[model samples]
Target: MALTADSPLTELLQENPKAAEILMRFGMGCVGCALASGETIRQAAEGHGIPLPELLEALGIEE
Candidate 1:
């Protein structure tokens, strides 16, 4: 499945394990956090003060 802002962190990782590296590079260490199970990519980005678009771009996720 394609990733989107609404994609849960766990789902994102399951679909694209390489996303972990990109997420970490962006200072999002939630890859191993329990909240990752429920947090959406957009939520994570907001919590980390990261611009959603930039993160999505880095993850190669279009919009």
Candidate 2:
């Protein structure tokens, strides 16, 4: 499934482990944290001060 800004971090990781690598590349190495289960892509990006569009693009997710 295509990932979106609202996709839960845990779901993304489960769906595609590469997503964790992508997040880490973006300096968001929180994929293993408990919050990853509850946090959305948008929320994670915001919390990490990452630009949402950039994160989406890196993840190959359409805005």
Candidate 3:
């Protein structure tokens, strides 16, 4: 499945291993967090005070 800003954190990590690195660089430590299963990329970005567009771009995911 194509990755998108709405994709769940777990789905994102599963689709792109590099995403974990990018998320970490953005100060999001959701890689192994339980909430990853339910948290969408957009939600994570917002929760972490990251710009949604920036996060999506870094993850190579479309908004």
Candidate 4:
């Protein structure tokens, strides 16, 4: 699924375990944290200072 800032981390993680690799590759590995639980893909990427295009590509989502 294409991800957006409104996409729930919990839901995304459940549907796409590959998302963890994408997030961590961008230096966001706190997938189990409370803050991460509610954070969206864009939010997390921004938080980690990851470029949106790069993050999107890594997640297999077209930007």
Candidate 5:
């Protein structure tokens, strides 16, 4: 399944290992944290002050 802002971070990481690198590049090095399991991509990005659109682009998700 394609990733989206609402996708759980853990699910995204499990589905695409490359997503770890993308998250790290965006200064979100908490992939292994417990919260990742329940956190959505949008929540993480918003918490880190990351622009959702930029992150989506980096993840190769179409806007």
Candidate 6:
């Protein structure tokens, strides 16, 4: 599935643990952190100054 700003990090990780690499690569190791448990991928990426499109690309998500 193509992830969006609405997709929670936890849910995505649950569906694919390998996705953790995507998060970590984007400097979002906080998917397991309390403050980011419910945060969306877009939100975390934005917070870390990472572009969402780049993140998706790192995760192998095609446009």
How many residue pairs clash in each candidate at the backbone level? 0, 0, 0, 0, 0, 0
The lDDT for every candidate, in the order shown, is: 0.90, 0.88, 0.85, 0.77, 0.88, 0.77
Preferred candidate (TM-score higher): 1 or 4: 1
lDDT of 1 by residue, 1-63 (tens): 788999889989899999999999999876798877889999999999999999998988877
Give lDDT tens digits, candidate 5, residues 1-63.
Answer: 777888888888888899899999999988889887889999999999999999988987654
Q: Which lDDT value does model 2 have at 18?
A: 88
Q: What's the CA RMSD for each of the models?
A: 0.9, 1.1, 0.9, 1.9, 1.1, 1.9
Q: What is the RMSD of candidate 5?
A: 1.1
Model 2 scores a TM of 0.90
Candidate 3's C-alpha runs over 4 A off are none
Off by more than 4 A, model 5? none
lDDT for each residue of candidate 6 in 5-35, tens digit (9 for 90 to 100): 6688877787779998778877776768986
Candidate 5 CA-lDDT value = 0.88
Q: 3 or 4: which has the higher TM-score?
A: 3
Question: For candidate 1, what is the TM-score?
Answer: 0.92
Candidate number with greatest TM-score? 1
Q: What are the models' TM-scores?
A: 0.92, 0.90, 0.91, 0.78, 0.90, 0.80
- The global Cα lDDT (0 to 1) of model 2 is 0.88
Q: lDDT tens string, model 4, 1-63?
A: 665555777877887887787777778879879998878777877887888778777776665
